[model samples]
Target: MISTTDIIISICYIAFIVALGFWAGLSGKKDGAAAGEYFLAGKSLKWPMIGMALFATNISCLHLVSLAQSGFDTGLLAGNFEWMAAFTLILLALFFIPFYIRSGVATLPDFLERRYNRACRDWLAVVSVVSAVVIHIAFSFLAGGIVLETLFGINMFTSIIAIALVTGAYTIVGGLRAVVVTEAVQTIVLLTGAVIITVLSWWKVGGWQPVMQVLQDGGQLDKLSMLHSSGDPSGLPWYAVFLGYPVIGIWYWCADQTIVQRVLGAKDENHARTGALFCGFIKVLPVFIFILPGLLAYVLYKQGHLDLEVLRQADGQLHTKGIYSVMITKLVPPGLVGVLVAALLSGLMSQISGALNSIATLVSYDLYKRNRPEATDQQLVKTGRIAAVLALLLSIGLLPLLNRYESLFNGINDVISHIAPPITCVFLLGVFWKKASSQAAQYTLWIGSALGAGVYLLGKLYPINIPPLMVAFYLFVVCVVLQVMLSFAFPMQHTAESNRLYWESPLAPLRVKGWPGLANYKVLSTVLLLMMAVLYWVFR
Candidate 1:
């Protein structure tokens, strides 16, 4: 159990985040009430802030907890999610960032509308808002509530309510500026705490050699493998990862509004590209700091250094959601528990704040302001604040539902697998194929979404034998074929503006001159790719 000191530290840390968030908001106030300032941080964010915010916003309390659970349950098998993301982030840096910066759209839906049609934009805006609420905000709240309940014995609902109010307050007032500013700080704290715990766990385990010996003796040495063979229990083989990951990865890392909003707030194209590549580099850390700890926890458990009875139910089935929490109490000392709780909250509220801001932006810009073109910036900002509160309430109510899945990471991704196929299909086609028609996009999104929903429900009612990643890949292929047929049926009459958006050829996006030396996006992207490849090789 956490001591009084831990509670005080957590409360103080929350207060600091609130104060800092408010400060960021007020400072941004002087920049004027323009939509650009409130929604996109006045388009003045540098690469460092953008990169850290991207990392922070994506690394929620859910990731910290669920990834550990995944680590304990499946070993290095789940690390593919962390590692495969590097490819998508590189795609974002090289291909997607240029268009996002040049287009100056506030949301990804707006990007779609410009690239496709208003119908595409409207469909995507609704999907974006819902996904941000469900995927980003609700999942984070559930994780936060779970952590609070575990360490301090607080009620999950009470914890969720408190966190939502605190995070939403700053998100409403400070907008993206406040969100990113606090996210940057949270990223640092999160990484520091993770590193500390990982180092401590490693030291306690008597170095990695002992861990290897334990696994080998236990006949669980395959736990160290990153890529699984066909028929592996994890259901994630190398082929599945390669084919399936890109389908959802592109949608999440490259196309999602919640993650990509930071890129949109960049000072310029170079900053946007470099920031995304920087985030790709940071992506290499989660496998070690987040997932490795869980692997270490398994090692400790086998060695009788930790107990996980709390993670089991009366029926004797393991939930594993509480693995990371159990590890925190068992592994770390007393006073540092406060810092760790603060770090959990850091992941929690940073994700909430970022997602809430993006939801507000999508609501105000895509849904509200587009209809009321003459609306003032003050009015747009007001609408956003209201939207943030509503989104928070909806997310809070969704906690029980979100908690149903045994694995939080897989649950979120399962939903993503269903949702991302059509969007990914549309985006890939829209950006790469000039012949991709607005008509094709409209029909593809509609028919493809219906198909995805049907497939998802089918899997739930009578489980689909295929892994979720393969499902996503197959769904994407269907959408691609559907769109291509639709495009041929209804040829595009591209506007001059839409024509400028897509590359004429595969090499077109790379033709533009990047910055000099190491900062060049091309240089950064290449290095990131090589680094990821080497890591994969080592792990394999």
Candidate 2:
């Protein structure tokens, strides 16, 4: 049970967060509804804010709970999701951000409209908004609700509503700037709490070596390995890691509006690239900060301090899901529990706010203003705020469906695997292939989405043991083939605007001088690659 002191500290933290969000809202208000100010933070975010906001937005409670549980179940291999993201982020900084900035589009859909057609833009916007509300925002609220219910005996619905209200209060008023600035603060809280948890866990386990020794003694050495055989159906296989994971990573790191929006808010290419690189570096922390803590909890379970039934399945595997909350309830002291709860809330709120703000941006710019081209800046902002509220309501309404999933992390990944391939195919081909006509784009989306949905349904209906990542890779390949076939048959009927959206058509790639001779982005990219290589090597 939560002590009074813990309750009070948590309340205080919530109040402080609300106040910070309001301050940011006020700053945004001063800009007077300029779409750029509200949606993209006036395109003036520095590298630090951009980096922190991106990291915080991406590392939500879903990650904290799900990733930790995954580590408990599968060991370090689950961290491949976090570590492999570096490659995609580097690719984003190197190849995508420049074109995105040069196009001067507010939303990802807006960029699609520029590169492809208005129909493509509209289709993407609808898909994006629906996904944000249904998947991202709803799942975030569910995670927060689970935490609150588990810790404080709060009703899950009540917790969801409370979290929605607190997050929406700032997001509706302040927009992206408020979300980003407050997220920077939340990132600090999250990391601090995670570090404390990790350190305490390490101590409890009698250090890393003992933890490894215990797992080995238990004949669970497979859990210690990051790489698994293709025939090993238990954890992530090598084929999925190499081919499938990158497809999901590309869509998530490079193409997702919730993530790319922060990079879009950067002042210039240098700041954007720097922020992406910084976020890439930060992405590597989950294995230690979040996942290792889960591993520690498993250690405690093995040591008999924790109830085996709470964290283990009937099949003798770790349940992994709900293990993080179990760890907190069983392990953390009172005041620190309050702080860690706040950190968990911070993660949830940041992602919710980011999703809310991005949804708002999409509706305001892509859907609203398209019909009312002469709409004032204030009008767009109002629409965005209204859209955010509606999205929140929709998310709350969908909360009941969340209980069906055994693992929130797996649920999210499954959803992403199904939805991401079509959009990823569109964006990748749209940016690189000059002849990727609007017809091809439209058909690919239709065909790819159909294929993805079919795959998902088949998996649900049958005993399809293929990982979602591998399924996504197959879908992506099919989509790419469809795009190429259609593009060649019907040549692109490009207009003046469409012609200039490519990499070298009119907007040249941004070149930067490094400290010595190489480009700065290249240097950072190399560092990120090296770090990833070292991590995999050590873990493998």
Candidate 3:
């Protein structure tokens, strides 16, 4: 049970976050409330802040709780998502950052307009906004509500509302500046809480060898491996990971509005590039701290170190939803349990705030300002605030429906697998192949979206045996074929601006000069790539 001290600590931490947000908002008034100031934090973010904000925004309690659930159910296998993200972030740093920075666009849709046409921009803006709502905000709310309910014994929807209102109150007023400042602090707290749980669990389980022995004794030792071959029952084989991950990873890491908006706020291209690479390094932690706890829970239970009776369900299966909270209550001592609660709330609030700010940007820039090109800064700011409020309300309403998924982590990726292919294809070809036409991209996004939805509906009606990763790969293949053929048929009519966007050769982006010493993006990217390879090799 949570003690009185725990509740007080939790309340105090939340109040501090809200106050910090209010301070960030009030501080920004010095810049006089320009649209750029509100939407992109005046484009003044440095590398460290941008990196932490990016990581914090991408992660939610969904990651802490559901990832632990995945670790318990599977093993190190679920780390594929976390690990594969490094490659995409590297892509963002080396190739995508220059275009984003040089073009000086507020939203990705604005980039689409400059690269393709207004039709492309308009379509992408709608899709990006919907995606920010569904993928980023709604799922964060769902996972957060589950965590809050587990810890406080409060009604799930009630806790969600209370948290959302608090988070939104500051986010609507403060914009990206408040979001990122709060996120940087939240990231530190989140990492510390995760470290506490992991260290405690690790000590309780008697370290790696015992955990291995427990799994080996149970005859499920395959749980220890990070990579699997084609015949592995996990369905996500090595080849599928390589082929399928890039499809969704490109969309999530490189092109998604919510995730990429932090980079958009960078003080310069160097900051944007290094910030993304910095995030790549941080991605290495989730597999250890977040997912490993669940594996530890499994190992500890097998060794009779943990009692998981509360996780038992009426249908004779484990109720994995509350597993992380169970660990907090069981293993963590009283005063510190508040730290864990605060950390969970940190993830929930940071993720929602980041997405809310991105929604506001997309609305103000892509939806509202474009239509009213003559709109004042105040008008655009007001429009964005309204959009953020509406977006939060819509996401709250989606919680009950999204709560039905058995595996929140898997369910999220399954939805992304269907939604991401066309956008990924468009961005990839538009940036790499100068021959890619505006008409072709517009048509590909339109047709490919319908095709993916149709496939999803068909899967529901029929027994489709393919894995979600493989499904995404196949959809990407079809979309690529359609875009390639259409591009050939329609031939691009690139202006001087669009011509600067694509490179002359594969090595072109690498030839550009970066910051001096080890901080150079090329240097950092190389080091990160080597580090990831070593990690996978050791875990393999």
Instruction: Evaluate model 1: give its lDDT.
Output: 0.90
Question: What alpha-carbon RMSD in Å does predicted model 3 have with respect to the real structure?
Answer: 1.0
The reply for model 1, stretches above 4 Å from the true place, is: none
Candidates ranked, most accurate by lDDT first: 3, 1, 2
lDDT comparing candidate 3 with the true structure: 0.91
Error of 1 at 351 (Å): 0.8
Superposition error at 279 for model 3 (Å):
0.5
Error of model 1, residue 349, in angstroms: 0.7
Per-residue CA lDDT of model 2 for 78-168, tens digit only, reads 8888888889998798778877887777889888988888888888888889888867788888877777887878898998898889989
lDDT of 1 at 71: 83
Global lDDT of model 2: 0.85
Model 2 clashes, total count: 0
Candidate 3: residue 160 Cα off by (Å):
0.3
Report the C-alpha lDDT of model 3 over 51-93, residue by residue, as the tens digit: 9999999888889988999899889898999999999999999
